[model samples]
Target: MAQLSADADAFGPMLTIEQAAERAAEHITAVAGSETVPLAAADGRVLAADIVAPVDLPPFANSAVDGYAVRFADLAAAGETRLLLSGRVAAGADAADVTTENRAVRVFTGAPMPAGADTVFMQEDVGLDAGAVILPAGLKRGANARPAGEDLPRGDTALAAGRRLRPQDLALLAALGLTKVAVRRRVRVAIFSTGDELNEPGTALPPAGIYDANRSLLRALVTHAGAEVVDLGILKDERESLVRRLREAAADCDLILTSGGVSTGEEDHVKAAVERAGELAFWRVAIKPGRPVAMGLVAGTPFIGLPGNPVAVFVTFAFVARTVIALLSGTQPVRLPGLPVRLGFAYKKKAGRREYVRVSLAPGPDGIAVARKHPRDGAGVLTSLTETDGLVELSDELTSVAEGTIAPFLAYEMLTG
Candidate 1:
């Protein structure tokens, strides 16, 4: 593993959230590789190139309903007009030619529109008597008939590059008569957790030892971000062991993620290991509950160190690590999706650091959805994440928020969806 030159000391103050995100974006780049896969396996993958439609969607003009196809000129305005029935056309069958002006053909839904027939009157709106159909008054031309290329045209872009394919996107490709597509390869991530007082579940606990929740949270988050995870488990607070694990991860994976040992504690070893192995790009971000977040490179592989607190780990990953993962997967980074929702309670904090409060939706006085803050504010409380619907973000310049004020809210799905 080779080390990059160190220039992180030149940056003086703790960086804002936006500044930290921009720095991470500048350092990371998309992997330059792609593979062709069948449509069945392309869901959740990023597209490598634009997909153009091979042919029109419908291929030909068709009937959109079960109706009688007739020439609009033969219908009268004040009274019903009679037309001789020529033939019937069902879906997936050939259309009948109605050459006579006063003739019509019985057509089912999705059936092809007959030749020389300008419009269709729904069967329920007309009458049939003695092998002849009576079209009602006020017949409109081209009614209930779907024209060719109405949904999609040939030679047009169907899906753009850098788009993460969803279930609906796969259906569109199938409709375009495509079985396979080119997609970026999945990103490989290596993750681990560090602390002396942390213990895995299903084990007897020592005095003052707590079970490790950060590892499980981090793993779930990485998987939800559409990346392949290489979980390295929990490492004890030892300098040499941390260095060895990081080196191995850098050699075998595209990026490294670790929780704990990056803060300014005397027992912290991960930060020093990062500085010795490579360059610690930045360690402190101006955000509450996750101010100890760190980003660096270990032997050219990007590394992000999240705080040990479960709430902090969740918040920092949603706002920061998610972008890095997207970049590594050959997709463009997305902004934190947020919308304005009314506040149901008052909140107060300092102006320099940003904060995210766990909140659930409640009914406001004006019948609009309002955000109600959770009672617990500790970073180590994992229930704050599980019980709340999402987070309410407060910017750096703002200090206090009164009841009924509008604030930005981020849903959990917006982070992973």
Candidate 2:
């Protein structure tokens, strides 16, 4: 791991969320290398190159329904027209042997259209008279017929580079006859928490010790962001131990992430430990619940320190670490857009800092969804997250919001996804 240059001091003491995000994007310029993988294993991996179609989708004109294929010009304009039954075409069968001039060909769905037949009457929409097929009038030409390349044309780019492949993307690649694709390697994240009062779960608690929750929270979040997590457990609030762990993690991980010990408290050794090992910058972001966040490099690996509070850990990670992960993983960093919903409760906040209020939704009399704020505002309230549907994001300039006002709401699914 080589340290990337991040002049964090240039931004001053406090940074807006947008400024911090931009700084991360500018400083973290390196991406993981790519590898070729089979299509079955490509899901959730970011694409390293564009996928171009070698052949047109469908490859040929085909019937969209089980019906009678006919020449539109041979049908009478105002009444039903009967045509001699000449041939039949089933799916996967060639249409070269069928002669279809003024005659009808029985075609099943996905069957290649017979030469000179430009229209199809669905089997349910026609009748049979003796050995002839009768089609109703007013059916337009090319009805129920799929033209070649209608979906994707040959030589066109089907999937672009930097896109995270989904299950549907695999189906498209398979349709393009691709057995393997080039994808960026998964990012390796080294995660740990620092605090003397923290204890592992499933163990008897000491007098005033609390269970460690941030590591498990971060592991799931890092994995969901398409990275591999190297859990380092909890580091005690000691300068030497913190420095040692930081150095060790930097040797093998792409990013070193930790929770707590980055604030101004005396036990906050992460900032000093990082400075001792490499470089660090404390970014006091103008956001509620997560103001004391830190970013830097440890022995050349990128480092981010989240706040101690569980809610703060989640918020900071969603906005800050998520971007770093995207950059390191070679994927496009897309900010999930907030959905607009009406506020059911009034709220007040300062003008300079952004706020994320936990809220639950209910349908109002006007048919619009209403967002009600949670009763607790403490950062340490873990139930505030589990009990709310999402967060109502109040912008930095917003001073107050009245009942019935429309506000931007970010659902948990959107944040985690």
Question: Which prediction has the highest TM-score against the true structure?
Answer: 2
**How high a TM-score does candidate 1 get?**
0.91
Measured with C-alpha atoms, the lDDT of residue 94 in candidate 1 is: 72
How close is every model to the real structure, measured as TM-score?
0.91, 0.94
How badly does each model clash, as a count of residue pairs? Answer: 0, 0
**What range of 10 consecutive residues in model 2 has the weakest lDDT sum?**
1-10
The digit string of per-residue lDDT tens for model 1 on 20-50 reads 7677666677777799999999988999999
- In candidate 2, which residue ranges exceed 4 Å CA deviation? 1-6, 77-79
lDDT of 2 by residue, 5-115 (tens): 556678678878888788777768556589999999998889999999999998999999999999998999889899999989999999997989999999999999999
In angstroms, how far off is 47's CA in candidate 2?
0.9
The positional error of residue 348 in candidate 2, measured at the CA in angstroms, is 1.0
Q: Which ten residues in a row have the lowest lDDT in candidate 1?
A: 1-10
